[model samples]
Target chain A: MNISEIRVLIGDDSILARKQMKDILEEVGVKNIEEAANGQEVVEKFRSFKPDIVFLDIVMPVKDGTVAISDICAEFPDAEIIVISSVGTQSYLKQAILNGAKDFVQKPISSSKIEEILLSRFERS
Target chain B: MYTQLFGNYLLSKNIITPDQLVDAIRKRNDVFVQPNTIAMHFKLISATDAEYVTKIATDKDSDFISTAINLGYFTREAYDEVKDNTLPEYLFLGQSLINDGILSSSKLEEYIVEYQSNNEMIDLELYSDQKDNLDQLLLNLFIIANEELPLYIGKYINLLFTNLIQFIGEDFTPLNFLPCEEYPVSLCSYQRINGVHPLTMYLDLDEKVALEFASRYVGESFTEIDEYVKASLEDFLNLHNGIYNVNLSNESSIEMKLDPPVFIEDTSITPGEKEQLYMLPIVYPFGTINFLFEIEKQETTSLF
Candidate 1:
């Protein structure tokens, strides 16, 4: 799939975090993007929106990103959910990967990392 | 970091008025380093000698390094090193005050001496990313609060300063501790740092300071304090704690986690059950904000 045609979902509790990721995704020419303020919302959006790429934060209100990742990946099986969170501790990273997250990037997120992920995802290998 | 600290010191010492300090802070960003200022920091030239060199260099329209070297105020070897050296931002505060005629170079020299002697932080310029210097700085802050500095807490405070400079602007200083009980909530956000180092941190400041802080953190200006502005404060605290958690885990295998920030509208706040509240006030170019760290007290196991 082309980079611009890829769908993106951002799940973070902070409005700042969502806006920041949205700005970076737009900068990278990703046109279809969806946002969820909490883990529950993100999981629901994932089921309905079926975004190709998901950015999840660990700490959220009702449900957490780890749980959301597990939920989405369990049903979809091929879900591409990346853990974008501040608390990227050893256990957190292990759990995120084991539970179904594709990659983990610690916050505050940088454009270079986003670009690298996108390039790696869309490039013909 | 020491730049804002020195500015705070001048205000505390009554050497410069609050208005003068704020004015200097607003203009301190305009200050670029000069060789004379670097020489003064190196102690190769006294502040008065620096002043004289500056005057002569100005009148003759000559370069300061060559003028000072010719005047025997600085040796050739000193000139070679000092020419390449840059002044610490700490001196920018004093330089700004001097330019505004609010202070004299000689008086600034005296305060620098007294402040260094008191805090044992001797020279701000040499505070070069050294762990020892950071520990000393944290110890001095604890000394100001009339308490002992624990090593564990020191690590967190050190990371706090590091993250503040990394995420926020460099124009800020951490003042002495503010008694938490005396605080009346204007705008406050709290987040729990859960795990081995159990603590809940709070960021409290007025709405105006919050707006400016949010602007700096997000790199965008907002005309008012709204949800995004509040989220900026929460995100900042969360971000700092998050990085600290990563450091702890990577260094010692002691993993920690952060809770989402809570914005409080209460008139006042107290520590959570079994937690003791400690507050530190940090001054930005915009205004003063407070950090309240509510540490969980250790429980003693009684053998009866």
Candidate 2:
């Protein structure tokens, strides 16, 4: 899979966060990108868009990223969900990994980290 | 921070008028003592050498110290010695106040003694160099009676000052924290920290100040409060809160999550029934910005 062909989904309650990540992904040659504002939206968008990669935030209004990860992985076991959160506690990290998240990135998100993740995932595919 | 605290003390004691304080701060910002002036004050360089270096610096578009060093007028050690004696802004403000004749030298000395005694502090010169001493002074100034809140609030404020120095300009003075029921905000961005202990942190600024602050953070001259300005302000808050949360997680094993920053315009934010709101006013060259921290004992029930 080429970088531009990868479908990316960003689930963050912050409009600025989503826009920032989208801009970074676009700069990394990601052509198809989708955004969700909450955990419920993340699961819904994952089912509809079936993105190759998902960037999820832990804190949201309707649903959180941790539970959404579990939901998405339960239906689509091959789903590649990356948990992105400002909180980097051991408990959250442990829970996110146990829920089948592929990786974790803390905020404020850096472009290099996104690119590294994207390059690694693309290589695996 | 001590400057603003001392200024407020002077205002409260009727020793200096508000106009005088403002004038002193404005003058303090404009007062830039050149290296030659400092060297002359310390008698490190002769007047003729200083004048020669000044001429060359102007002609070469260089600094006085570098030009003097290049011309062998003064050693680097002498330049460092002169630089070491440079005064901090608070002292500069005091000198400016005295120069303006708003307060006599003797009266200023008395006020300094009283301010130090009331705050149980040492000389201002040492206070700026010592972080622990400055933190102690901040605790004394802001945390009057609160016990637990002071620990978090003090850490938050210390980190805040560090961030302000890192991102924004370092030439700022923090005023004493004022307890207020509500703040009339022109532009405000805030985030809530939820988990074991919950707190709401916000930066409130006047429209013009917000534009200036965003411009400084983004390294762009923003003339208006547009989406870019708003996003920059929100990103700043998020970055600060995110760093604070990471520290808490790494050091204390505490799990606290941050809500997405919300931007509000032309409104007043009121504290909850059980919450206490503190407005920390920080004065910059452009304007003053108030950082509002609201903390409550009760656990947050809602997710948003």
Candidate 3:
């Protein structure tokens, strides 16, 4: 996928995590990027950024990714969202997929994970 | 009740050697002597940055942001800024290597799609895998060692291999310690270094279990480390080792060794520095646990 052509939204609660994700996204040639701190923020950013892919955190302060995904999916069923989280439980993974999240990424986000998410969601689709 | 019952159970089972039991305690007192701590001592991060994440923040149940933001180091906005970018802590790079780039690009994309499209909520219940089991055992070892030798250094380590073995019922090989500047040691990616000091321990269990165990130990009952707690911890390791031994008794008669428990005071011991005191780590069911001891004399009740 061309980095400059992809539009992405990043969400999470750890400052260190956000930086790493941003760096990794840029590394994969992603240029149009938006960011959010929680589920609610993701919603706001999702509307504003209208990204091709949204990376949402599972756990957050104002709103969690799960609820946000539900709300966004209800409104924009085509919304492309991924649950970003530190805890990797099977149940959560299943639920995120059910709720409209396109994928999930564990904490200490890796560059490869972001690249994979973008390529599959935007480039392939 | 938890400590004595668990300790005696392991001792009677003969899972861990007397020497290993003692070493566990020593390792605990010297807990602060890890390579990361040593890095702090060497001024890698500011004194504030070097401050170990408190017991609460380190726990599995604790909220990550609450732990960091409560520190008063960063404002909500600043914290949010970093959090949104998904910037990883420097410590996590090592664990990411397993599947980060190893999978084929298409396979990786498939997993990501599965991840993003999924909407399942994670259950907060505690579960055990071989990794969790190993973590539980290592945690017990740490608890037991800390109980016996509150002032001595305790250490744990994990052996790294391309392929991880997770047999249903078998004892695995223990970790092999490399020589350290401090004698005791410890990985995650984006970070690597060596050190010395006798008061550090390391483990390479699954990060999930490590986070869970840390939460359990730090949250319940352990307010400030003291003698009473240390004794109980020693017993915990003893029992845990016994459980571990039973899991592998069919394959080998390998016995873990321990040193006589002792105390430490005043004299400084730095980990990842001073190369003379290194401990070798062996692989267990899930991972490795290793430690080094720094002794001090003190009067205490006999270990009858």
TM-score of 3: 0.35
lDDT of 1 by residue, B113-151 (tens): 887776666466556654565566565554334453234
User: DockQ of every model listed?
Assistant: 0.77, 0.52, 0.01
- When superposed on Cα atoms, how far off is each prediction in RMSD? 4.9, 7.4, 26.1
Best by TM-score: 1
TM-score each candidate. 0.82, 0.72, 0.35
Cα displacement (Å) at residue B256, model 1 = 1.9
For lDDT, the strongest prediction is 1
User: What is the Cα-based lDDT of residue B69 in candidate 1?
Assistant: 85
Clashes of 2: 0
Query: For model 3, how does the per-residue alpha-carbon lDDT over A1-125 read when each residue is reduced to its tens digit?
Result: 55578788887654434655787887887778777866788888878878877877665567766788998899889987877664344544666899988776654356777777677655642
Task: Say which prediction, candidate 2 or candidate 3, comes out ahead on lDDT.
Answer: 2
Q: In model 2, what lDDT does residue B86 have?
A: 51
Instruction: Enumerate clash totals for all models, in the order shown.
Output: 1, 0, 98
- Candidate 2 global lDDT: 0.77
Q: Residue-wise lDDT of candidate 2 within B1-304, one digit each (tens)?
A: 4554567567667777756776777676776655665665455666566767788899999998888888887789877866876565555666677678786444665677787777667665455556666666557555543443546677677778778877787666666667888888888888998867788998988888888898888667988778878877777887788778877777677778878678898889899898888887877767888899898845333211
Ten residues in a row with the worst lDDT in model 1 chain B?
A: B295-304
Fnat for candidate 3 (0 to 1) = 0.00
Q: Which ranges of candidate 2 are over 4 A from the true structure?
A: A123-125, B1-31, B40-131, B144-149, B219-221, B297-304
TM-score of chain A, every prediction, order shown? 0.96, 0.96, 0.87
